[model samples]
Target: MRDAKTLFDRLGGKDSIEAVVTEFYHRMLADESVAHHFEDTDIAAQRAHQTQFLSAVAGGPVEYSGSDMETAHKGMGITDAEFDATADHLDAALREFDVPKKERTDVLAAVASYREDIVEADSTDN
Candidate 1:
């Protein structure tokens, strides 16, 4: 049995979530390995969706209206290495926002749980 406080609450609620997600975009944009994925994308909208999605998953009141992970990542040709690199940025973002160690680890672990849903198979491998 876990404590009653939600990750969202421990994370300082909606405002903190927005701030962290914004910082996450900053980290992602500066990363050469994953920057291209966002080149033509609408960043504001993307961040909004991300904030909402992260909120929903973290036990907040917002509902996420974004595309499913597989569909959203389709044709992106995302590799495992790139995905891991992106996850690293996420961890850094959470740390930069001063999320607790256990919460940060748990957050990334939850994100990593979607590895298969987000990673596309490389056709060139075969």
Candidate 2:
């Protein structure tokens, strides 16, 4: 039996990953529910960080250089609905890139696994 190809490989490697990441951020920035999160952020830096982050998560050669998910999102008051909306943008981006269903499912699942770390509801504040 042979080992399955890594998602990175299935995703058409670095150049394709960069394209996906770029388009993903464009979609994200256009999504009102999540666009606020990147309001003051540098799009170039965010794209670079996210490209590396996705590359690492997809089992590529690069390691993610960003802060840990929880530390990075702390106090941001992200909610479950916002998270789902963000994922929806990512899904649309992948579809725009013509990514196959199985690979997109894997990518979405990997990102969704971090929901606990990324979502921080501020119930007490309200």
Candidate 3:
């Protein structure tokens, strides 16, 4: 299996990642619903953290020893609808970056793999 670093390198590494992320956030912030979540937060720090997180996830040299996703997002009050909209923004960014469809799928799959860790449902009993 190709490691994330190798795959990321093929996708153009940090520069490309930053480009996509910037575009993703730009689009996200423009959307009223998504913007609300970030209203009180420092978007700069959020952007930096996201970059570091993605770098580590992509197997780059960066180390993201940050808080676990669940804890980090636990009280954010993020609904499934919000999550999906964020994902759509990401997809749009990838498309704008001209990422190949297969690569886009792989990246999105990686993002999806973290769903359980990032999402908090109202009831675990369901």
Candidate 4:
């Protein structure tokens, strides 16, 4: 009999997820478009939260204890362009680790579900 592996296992479990999260943040920090969003953020703490969140999203045993997407991003004024930049960084991270195309698509799709909560309309000073 074959054991059914979850996406988390297929994605290489906690250690791999942690590595991807670290790489993801590194990419984000280097990106001029989205780097400012994290200027005042505690990156270590954010990485921990992201690791847990991604694990849960990938069907791991970890439960994410962080704030909800909307509350966590409240008042950030994250525009669609900024959100796209962030997604691009994540995609790059996954690719850097040689994650398979289908798995990458799955992860991106899961994260994309929260776009409405994470992205806010661009505010203008008119």
Whole-model Cα lDDT of every candidate shown, in order:
0.86, 0.89, 0.80, 0.91
Q: Indicate which candidate wins on TM-score.
A: 4
> Considering lDDT, where higher is better, how would the candidates rank from best to worst?
4, 2, 1, 3
* Candidate 1 Cα errors over 4 Å, as ranges: 1-3, 122-126
Candidate 4 lDDT over 1-126, as tens digits, reads 539888899899999999999999999999887889899999999999999999999999998888899999998888888888888899999999999998899999999999999988763421
- TM-score (all chains, Cα) for each model: 0.91, 0.92, 0.86, 0.93
Of the two candidates 2 and 3, the one with more favorable lDDT, higher being better, is 2
Number of the predicted model whose lDDT against the real structure is largest: 4
Candidate 4 wrongly placed segments (more than 4 Å):
1-3, 123-126
lDDT of 3 by residue, 1-126 (tens): 754446577668888888888888899899997798788888878888887777677667788988988888887766677777888898899899898898787777877887877767543322
Error of 4 at 74 (Å): 0.5
lDDT of 1 by residue, 96-125 (tens): 988889989877887888889898955344
Error of 4 at 45 (Å): 1.0
Error of 2 at 88 (Å): 0.6
In Å, residue 47's CA in model 1 sits off its true spot by: 0.7
lDDT of 3: 0.80
The model with the greater TM-score, 2 or 4, is: 4
Find the number of clashing residue pairs for candidate 2: 0
Residue 52's lDDT within candidate 1 is 87
Residue-level lDDT for 21 in candidate 4: 99
RMSD of each: 2.6, 2.2, 3.5, 1.9
Q: Write the number of the candidate with greater TM-score, choosing between 2 and 3.
A: 2
